[model samples]
Target: MKRYKKYITPYLSAFVIGPLMMLTEVAGEVMLPKFMSMIINNGVADRNLAYIGKMGALMVLTVLFMAVGGILGAYFSAKASISFTSDMRNDLFQKVQQFSFENIDGYSTGSLVTRLTNDVQQVQNVLMMGLRMALRAPGMFLGALIMAFMMNRQLAVIILIVIPLLLAAIILILKTAFPRFGEMQRRLDRLNSGIQESLTNVRVVKSFVREAHEIEKFSRLNRDLKESSLRALRIVITTMPVMMFAMNVTTLAVVWYGGNIIIAGKMPVGDLTAFTTYIVQILMSLMMLSMVFLQSSRASASMKRINEIFDTEIGLNDDNAKNKDKKVTEGRVEFKNVSFGYSGENGRKDLVLEGISFMAEPGQTIGIIGSTGSGKTSLVQLIPRLYDVTGGEVLVDGVNVKEYSLKHLREGVGMVLQKNVLFSGTIEENLRWGNEDAPMEDVIRFSESAQADPFVKTFKNGYGTEMGQGGVNVSGGQKQRLCIARALLKRPKILILDDSTSAVDTATEAKIRESLYHDLKDTTKIIIAQRISSVQEADQILVLEDGKIIGHGTHEELLKTCETYSEIYTTQIGNQSIGAGEEAAV
Candidate 1:
């Protein structure tokens, strides 16, 4: 919370003024009862019209002040709290953006969304409530208690008895309420996760006719959230009844004792009236404070969740890089005995890629062919430093990948991932993500090279056409080409395509490969493909199996020496004997 001082400092005036204005409202509220008592005991009884009119005018003036103060308090509180949370949310988002793939794996996407939206909102709401009442509640209680004692000390003693009882109840309720609120937030996370998953893959769900299953899952999550919310709220709501009961008992005690005193002509009726009002005020302030506490309990849970984001140490950063100023110049990528695995609990690494070693010189196309889960994607991912190698060093241009700053390193390499993703925007805008300042000429040129230009122009808006979220508006082949076009716009020193052209037809795929080789001769290219034909013309081919490269050579060389490569080639294109003509001549 102390770390939040910077956010508050910017809105310091609002923070200060909000509470002060609330105290002014409290000042008027505490005095209103006294004014009413004066009008009842003095003005009415004395039969003086002038005094009554004057007192009535003062009461009106006091109410006017209270009205002004309350309005100012609410406005400033909202201004300050909203501004505070806005800054906090931005910082939280920035921190999330800094997270490497490994760090992100620690949190669910739904959990992060909840932390940014729901959790930040909870803290903002509580901050607003607290600003309005944090000081006012105590101010009213103290002011009312002082007035009650001044009116009659004996009656005030009854308040002291009920105060402890109310305090005990509030404490007990809060104890149970905090943990329940935490559980409620966790349930909310689950609901959000379920919703996100179902909606994001809604096409799959519909294709498989799993709508009923998804609905059932959502209903269960909804029910769980509802139940948890009720549990948290039920405990907090109990406080209101307990406070009211205490207030009633205390009021009755005051009236009984004060009535006896009045019968003996010991206290004036005006004073008794004021004393009773003060007693209510005191108890009401305590209730207000208790409600603040209850809100804070819920907000505390949210703040804890938010702080988890802030507290997360980003596993990937260039802070300690020796060559932070260095850029990837040549795109000469080399993996030297690299072994990588996702770290599990207690820092255990189950290797996905074992003893991976290769080198791709600038202007060379390296083809990585492997079965599913054979770490083809894993090897290339290390190039962009998406995940650091767990065992050995990955080098680019003779410098260790870790030595280069992430911004410069990633800027030099372009990757079109296995799953092609496009955002909700115009087609041109999505393409511009590769290079924001790229000219329209460059955009069209690259699109042509990726074989996307023709189909893109077929759309009514062409490049200006609005794309659905994740490019749902386009066909799979169109999406793949668009992704490839986007990557080419980067004009990076190194380009990695992880089965990016899988959806395109063989002719179109061949055209794309031809374009890559022709257009990006200076840029190092690494292609991971399922189809053997896709990488048959590559400068070098690495055949992988069971997390190891079992064969490495040119296509013809592999056919002669490598069994795995031959099997893949035979399975894909049929065994066309390269020596059949020579055998026929013999």
Candidate 2:
């Protein structure tokens, strides 16, 4: 409630005025029936044309006033709810942005999307409906009930019996509906996940001829969602008929009992007619109230889910940093007996890298070679504090990396990941992510160093050319080159390339290496690659196997001393010779 005050306080006027306006409609509703009754019982009974004409004019004026009130009520409610939702959505997005990698692992991309969009929509709908009817329905019920009893208490007694029955039915339906709504929302999460995964990888699905498999998978999820929705909605389906039945039965009781009074001359026909209208108003108000409660049940489920996100404990933050003001100035990196792992089921640690220790001085190029799943990427990720070490300390510039704020620590290191990702924007716009205020000359210079400028110039729009989502319009090697260019523009003290150039040819890779060694002579370079040639000239190289470092030396030292390194080098050379011979024969 305290958190929500920020969203509601700014719209306090609309929140108050909306329901107050609805009260005006309630006042007119109660008075109009009496006005109609007067025209019938007084003017028509006495055959007075002037009395009937005056009452008719009053009824017309009351309806016009009610119409104006209803319109204002609706407009204000919508304004308040829409504004509240807009502000809440923005806050929720900011909260998600603050989530650490571990926190994000607790949620899926699609589930977060659902929470930000669908869940907030549910809260908005309830707010809008509640604002309009929260006061109006109860006001109508009380006012109409008072008038009914004043006109004839005998007829109002029948309403008491019908009210309890309707109340019981509504309570039972709501109790059964709440859990079903929760289940339906879970199914919606699964369906959204399926859709997002399929669409994001639609090209891969087609390339592998798995489109049919994906379609069937989607159909299964869709069917499950439909079934869950129907289960939840079946309670609503049962509610409407039950309420209508109770309304009809109550109205019949009023008309039947009141008819006897009118015939016996104990009540006027006009009074009986007015009494029946009040009975309908009372029951209809109950129906409106029931609908509000039903919507509230679903909103409660949504709010519970949203609170989960807000309640999540962010495990990684600089809140306890001993040196929060410290920044990474010199990019000298060292790992001191660092052992890292991810948490698994039952609170167990699944160790990925064990007892790893290394160092790279500023202006040195360190090469890391490993088999698949040997934790090459994991090692470099620690430099940026993307994931913290579980055992020992990682230091940058002789200070613990955890002591630096994440923003400053990451800004000093530039990383190009194995998977290249480009957003939907122009090429120049993408490069600006590295340095938003970079001039055109710097952009072109970095592009040339990355071996991307020649190909980019061939495009009709050059740097202005649009790259489709995820760079789908470009080839794999081009995407990799552009990613390198973006990272190069940052001019960081430490640059880590995690197999970022696997898609490019060996000659182009050599050129890129030469550019880095020549131009960024002072930067610390860490290259993780599979081919030995890629790192043959590196100042030092480390070989990893099964989460442990088995060898460490310069390229020649490793080749002569490390048996594993020697075999890898010999195998790659032999394969290159065989490929050259096959090409000559062709």
Candidate 3:
């Protein structure tokens, strides 16, 4: 919270002025009853119309002032609270932008979304309520109490006696409510996760005829959220009744005692009348205070969740680098005894990639072939400093990757991931995401090289055609090519294709590879592929198995020297050979 002092400091005027105006309302409210008492006992009792008229006018003026104060207080409070939360949300988003892949892996996507949107909103609403009532409640309560005691000490004692019991009930309920609210927030995350999964995969759910199954799963998550929310609210709601009951008993005691006092002439009727109004004001303020506590209990949970993001020390930083001023000038990549693992909150001692070492010369195409879960993506991600190596150093242009700033390092590497994604925009807009200032001629040239230019022109819009979210309007092969075209716009020093062309036909894949070699000869290339034919012509091939490189050499060099590479090549060729033989026999 102290870290957020900068955001709070600017709103100091609003914070102070809002409550001061509220105190003005309290001042008017407290005096109106006393004026009524004066009109009743001194003016009305003496049959003096002049005194009654004057005091009556004063009471109306008091109410007018109170109304103005309340309105001004509300205006300032809302202005301050809304601006505060808006700034806070902006900072939270910036923090998300700074997070490395490792920082993101520690939290679920749904949880992060919930924290940013729902949780931030919860805190904002509560803060608005706080700005309006936080100080006003106590001011009204204390002022009314002082007025009551002055009128009749005995009657005020009754309110004092009931106050402690009401406070105890509220404190007890709050103790239980805070944890329930926390549980409710966790359930909301689950509900969000369910909705995001179901909608994102709606086509699969429909194709598999599992719409009914998804509904059942979503219904369960929704029900859990409902139940937790009800439990938290139920506890908070119970506090109001307890407060009201205490207020009623105190009011009764005041009436019963004040009646005897009036009969004994120990208290005047006007003073007794004023005491009851003060009692309502005092008790009602107490009730308002309890509600604030209840709202705050929930807000506290959300604040904790938000602070978790703010408090996160960026996992990747250049402070410890031996050469902080180093920049990646060339694309020669070398991994020297590198190991990495997905670190969780608990910590990680074992690595997903162990003893990984390799070297790729500038402008060389290095083919990475591996089975599923063999860490092909993990290996290349290190070169871009997406994830830091745990055991050894990754060097680019003879400088350790940690030495280069993240912006400079990442700008030099262009990666088309395993899952090709295009945002919701025109095709040209999506392509320009890699290089916003790239010329139209460059865009067409890269698209032609990716073999996407022909189909793109088939659409009447050409490059201006609108792409749906995730490129759902386009076919898989089209999306892959578009992503490749987008990457080419970067003209990065190093380019990585992690199964990015798997959906394209072999001929198209061959054409794209040819363009990568001949059209972009100066750019170092790394291709991670499942098919041997895809990487057979690479400058060198590295075969990975169970988190280790089992073979490394040119295709011919590996076929003669490496058993792992031979078995993979033979199995594919042998299967195709038998199929060809059977066709000839028929």
Candidate 4:
């Protein structure tokens, strides 16, 4: 709760102004009864019309003061609440961006979305209501009680008895409903997760004809959220009736006891009437305070949940060594006996890469071939320090990658992912993401090299053609080509193509590879592919099985020595084999 101090000043102003507003309300209420008493006992009883007119005008002036104070207090309090919540929303978003991948995995995408939107709204509502009611209700209640006691202590005694009963009712409601509201929020998160998951994979559900199954799963979560909310509402609903009943009983006691005293000549009729108004005022103020407590309990639950994300410490931090000296090499990559596994208490024991050792100098092409899930993508991800190795060190140039600033290490490596993703923009706009100040000549050259220029030119607007979300307007092969061209535009020292050519036909794939080798001879390349044709011309090839490297050599040497490479080569290219001319070039 104290973490929100930065946003508390405005709320504190609302608190201070609230008492002033309520002071005017009490003064107005008290003075109105006095005017009525004067009109009844002095003006009307003495047949004095002149005094009546003066008292009426004084009553109107007090009412005007109360109205002005009420409006000013409401305006400032609303302004403060809105400004506070806006700052909270911005801070929450910034904190979420700072979270590491591991920390983010603890929360589902939908749950985080709900916390940012719905949960924050709940806290905002409470802040506004607290300003309007919290201070005013207490001051009005106590002030009215003091006035009633001064008028006639006998009638005020009923208020003392009734106020405690209302307080007890409020406490009972909060104790039961507060915990239930927390559970309701958790259930809402689950419901949100179910909806998001179903929408993201709607294609899979339709293809498998499992729409009914998905609907049923979502319905179950929705029903649970509804039930939890209803249970909390039932507890809160008890508060209003119980509070009104206590107030009603106290009112009846005041009227009955005051009537007997007036008739017995123990009290005046004017004082008894004023006493009734004060008693009603006290009861109404208590009821408003009870309502504020009910809302505060629910908001307290939401605030705690939001604060949890704000308090999460970022796991990854820049090293002091990187700050002092942040130089990194172009394309010299090395993995020294590196082993890695996902970190958690119940995480898998089987390592993704076990004791893998490799080195590639500048201007060399390293080919990685493996079965699916053989850790090919995982290995290249370490060079840029996307995820640190669980054991051993990854080096660029001669320095440990962790010692270099992440910005310096990533700038030297350009990557094309296995799944092509494009932003919603024109072709020229998308290409500019790789190099902001890239010239048009450079864009055309890379596009031509990656075999994407021909198709791009065929479009009505060419470079200005608009791409839909995720490049949905383009074919898969075209998307892959554009991504490859984008990476090439960076003119990086090390280029990684992770099965990037899979969407294209064999002829196009071969032509692109030939052009890449000829044009990018000076750039170091790491190609991870399932096809033998993609990597046959490389300087060195690595064959991985499970998590270990089983072979490392040239295409001709590996075909003759390594069993896994020989088997893959036989299956892909067949027994026709490479001729003397082809073998020498490969």
Candidate 5:
């Protein structure tokens, strides 16, 4: 509700316009009854055609005014509703971006997308419909009742009896249907999640011959959504017929009671006719109110879902970090007693890294070799503050990473993930992602150094060739080289490659590495790889097992001193023996 109050000024203006439109509608309804009474009591009784013509024109003019008021009210109300929803969507998108990894992991991507798109749209529709009808229904109902009582108080009794029964039926329907609508929304989120997952992994699904299985799963979820929707509709469908039946019975009673009054000379024919019309008007208005209630019920459910995201406070805050006189520096990283676990409250039994310590000076390369799930990627992610250390601290350039502004920290580091992703754009456009203002010459230089220039030159448009979504148009090796080129464009102080060269051939990998070592002599490099040959030339190597560093030294030093490093090297490089002197020569 507080989130709703933020747009109060616009809503208040809409509320004010709604009543003015209602007043015009009431005036038009009021004039019809008076005109009918005049036709019977004055014009027809005295046979005065001129009086009937004059009253008929006045009624037509009143209707015209009502139409104009309705148009104006609709225009303003729609504008307010659309503007409010647009602002809310922007706010939600920005809020989602601000959330920490912990907060983001709590909600599925599909669920957040549904909340931003469909849920917000549902609420906006309710606001538009509620503004247009909420005011008019009550005004029409009460004004008609007042007019009916003034004409003949006895006939108005039928409306009093009928209105209460209608109200009870509406309340009963709402109580049953509102809960079902909320359940329907939850089911929709699940359906969206399934579709998103399947689409993202379409190739895997096809490779496994699971198309039929996926179709069946989607059908089951679709059926659940249909069932929930039908249940809510069933409840609402019961109310309309019951209300109409009650309205017809009330109409019959009014006619029967008014006939007796006419015969007893208690009411004129014209007044009885006007009285019946007002009774119909009141019942119709009540029906409109019931419809408004139904829409508001659905909107209420959607609002609760939207507010859940809005109410969540972002977990990461840099408010207390020093912001004064900060300067970006060449990357020199150190980790001291750093321990981390993915589980927040489940203790450190599932720790990814335990009591880890390491150091990498500027212009030197550190190789990280580990088995799967050994926290290699997790270790490098700490440098860029992707996730803050659960215990101890990671330092860059001798200062704690947490102490630096996120903007400066991220700008000084470049990373290429194991799973390479690319956006849809030309080759040049994608290369410019790392440094938006990189010169054409720098782009070509980095591409050639990464061994991506050959294939890029093969395209008719060369650097201007379009890549499909996620660079699906390119082969795996091409994507890897392009991602490396992107990172090189940043000219980062710290460059971390997490198995980025796996898809390329070893010869190309060696060439790229040789070029990188020569070009980036003043930059810090960290390489995570499965192949020992990929990292054997590094200044230092660290071998990890089960989230703990078990070996650290140069290749020759580790081969002589660390058993784990030797076993892995022998397993990958085979039993062919090479002297330590010969190994260093490569």
Candidate 6:
């Protein structure tokens, strides 16, 4: 509540005005019955036409005021709630953008999406209802109860007994429903995760003919979500029937007790009639109160989830950071006995990269090759401070990476990741992500260097062609080229290609490397590839096994000095030689 004070601060006027306007409705409603009683007992009984007419006009005016109050209350509620959610959603998005990869890994993408969209809506809805009903319901309840007691005290005892019973029931239902609502939200996250995973891997699913399996898996999650939703709402739904029963019982007691009182000459006929109206008002207010409680149960769960994100102290902020305003101009990069792992547990966790020592001089081309799960990707991820080194230090331009601001460090490194992504937009729009101000000539120059220009021009729209979501419209090889071109457009001091060209042919990969060497002569380039041919021409090559660096040298130097490097090169060339002989025979 304290942390969320900022959101309420901007809308304080609306928040105040909405409930105060609703009070006008409450006052009108609570007074109308008393006016009717006066009209009936005095005017109708004594045949006083003047009094009847005067009181009747007052009642009409009150009803009109109530109508105006309701509309105004609704207006303020709308304005306040819409504005609140807008600010909340924007802040949530900015928070996510600032999250380090480590922070992102702490939450699933689907869970975060649910919190941002569905959970926020739950809170928004409750806020709107609270603005309109929070004050009005309680005001009406107390006012009507007081008026009922004034008309006939004995009959009011029924309300005293029944109201407490209903309150107890609401408390009980809410206690059970709160935990159930949290479970239901978790189930919704699971369902969303399933849907996202299935759609993103649709191509693989189709290739394997696994549509039926996917459908079955989805159906199971959907059914779990349905059951969880029903369980939580069943508690909420039960409140309505229990409240209606209490209302009806209270109404019957009022009518029965007041009828006897009037018969005994202890209460007037008109007063008995007014007492019934007050009884109805009291019960209705309780119903509104029960609805408020029910909504609060669900929204309370959402609030906790929302506050969790706000409370998550960003572990990668620039506070207490050295070289906070400094820049990294040179491309030189070094790792000194660097070790990292994904976990942050108290005990020692498995290290993904251990005791790794490496250095790349400015303008050097470094190749990293190893078997799968050999920490090649993880090693480069440390360069951009995506994840901090667990044991030692990573340095760029002779400064510890932790010293430089994240923006400066990342700006100096252009990366085409192992899993590349292009957002939904035109080809030009995606390329401009590296350098938004890049001109047409720069775009063409990089595109040609990436071996992407020829294919791009073949399309009707050329650079303006629309790429569907995640670059779905392009072939794998074409996407690789476009990604390479985008990175080239950045003109970064350090460029990392993490197996980004595996989809292209060996000849095309060779051409890309040639253009990179010629065009980006001063850029420190790191290529992580599985193919020995892809790395053979590099100035330096590293052979990794497990999480350790096992070999390091140039192509000819490694082939003679490192057995692991020699075995890999011999195997790749032997296979290629066999293929060449077979092709010549054919």
TM-score of each: 0.97, 0.98, 0.96, 0.87, 0.92, 0.98
> lDDT per model, in order?
0.93, 0.91, 0.90, 0.83, 0.86, 0.91
Candidate 2 residue-wise lDDT at 489: 96
Query: Which portions of model 6 show Cα errors greater than 4 Å?
Result: 47-50, 344-348
lDDT tens digits, residue span 460-555, model 3 = 999999998888999999999999999999998899999998999988999999999998898889999988999999999999888899899999
* Candidate 3 vs 4: which has more lDDT: 3
Instruction: Tell me each candidate's RMSD, in Å, in order.
Output: 3.4, 1.3, 1.8, 4.5, 3.7, 1.4
* Predicted candidate 6 versus true structure: per-residue lDDT over 407-482, tens digit per residue: 8888889999999899999999999998999999999999999999999999999999999999999999999999
TM-score of the candidate numbered 6?
A: 0.98
Per-residue lDDT of model 5, residues 185-222, tens digit only: 88889899999988988888999999999999999999
Selected candidate, larger TM-score, 3 vs 6: 6
Task: List the pairs of residues colliding in candidate 3.
Answer: none
Instruction: Give the winner by lDDT: 1 or 5.
Output: 1
Q: What's the best-to-worst order under TM-score? A: 2, 6, 1, 3, 5, 4
What TM-score, to 2 decimals, does candidate 5 have? 0.92
RMSD of 4: 4.5
Better lDDT candidate (1, 2): 1
Tens-digit per-residue lDDT, 1-586, candidate 2: 9989999999999999999999989999999888888888999999999999988888888999999999999999999999998999998898888898878988988899999999999999999999999999999999999999999999989988888888899999999989999998888889998999999999899999999999899999999999999999999899888888888888888888889888899999888889889988998899898889999999899988898888888767888688777777778999999898877788688889999998899999999998999989988888898888989999999988899888888889999998889999999999988898999999999999999999999999999999999999999999999999999999998999999889999999999999999999989999999999998899889999988899899999999998888999999999999999999999
Model 2 global lDDT (CA atoms, 0 to 1): 0.91
The weakest ten consecutive residues by lDDT in model 4 span 315-324
TM-score of 1: 0.97
